[model samples]
Target: MKTIKPILFFLLFFFTISCVNQKQKDQEEIKQTVKNYFNAVKANDLEKCKLLIEDSENYLGVIQGEFNFLHKNYDEINPNDVLLRNILVKDTLITFTNEKEKYVQYIIKNDKNPNNLKKPLIITFMFYKPVGYDKIFNRVILENHIGWDK
Candidate 1:
């Protein structure tokens, strides 16, 4: 009985370490995905962004189109002026954390677009990782709003 306890304790400790390492790896991959995704968007490369995603639509371009329209119509706006500054990520901590990691929220921020777009269009993405998957299997844009100065 005493030996069993020690064995179980070691197993649990190793499992915890493994889980942490996995989380770290996931974070790195997710960060890279974000950088690639937005860089593609900024450059208007819809195909590249689509390929980076596992199972998702090319909706980022739709948002880009809107920005383009504003840039063309408004002298104060320039889509190229939008620059991504940081990307924030947080896990949803759902019931199936182990099986899916359910949802991860990513808030992408851009440096102030002097183009009268006050918020500079904050983009939020919800990413999901499936069980036994090396990459995120699902993703959706939660929000993309460029509050106008007008």
Candidate 2:
């Protein structure tokens, strides 16, 4: 009975560690994919950006509120380099909500790079809806323009 208990405990511990590692890998992948997407945007590489973003139509919601100026027909985002940092991937979704609420569903790159040491990198093209549009005024609203600290 003592031996069995030890074996069971070890198995549980092993499984827990494996799950945690997997989650960490997934997060790192998502981060890298987001980084790549932004790099492409900075270079004005529309084709590369399109490859990263999901093909689903209406990824970004309608621009009826103060964000109407941002509306344009294009797969890749054309935000200024300063605003590029506003995009991030938390978990499975690559969220771009700060500047102008947006989200995308993505897929992970299967090929692994041992040198990179960042595995399970997740990528997604997401969509988002503004929480409160009625509160905004007629003037241009530039709320939350901060970027991610390096």
TM-scores vs. true structure, each candidate: 0.55, 0.43
Q: List the residue pairs that clash in candidate 1.
A: none
For candidate 1, the 10 contiguous residues with the lowest summed lDDT are: 69-78
Task: Tell me the deviation in Å of residue 3 in model 2.
Answer: 1.1
- What is the C-alpha local distance difference test score of each model? 0.52, 0.39
**Candidate 1 off by > 4 Å:** 54-85, 93-120, 131-150
For model 2, state the Cα shift of residue 66 in Å: 16
RMSD of 1: 6.3
Model 2: per-residue lDDT, tens digit, 74-137?
1222335433454453423335643443333332322334344333323233322233211111
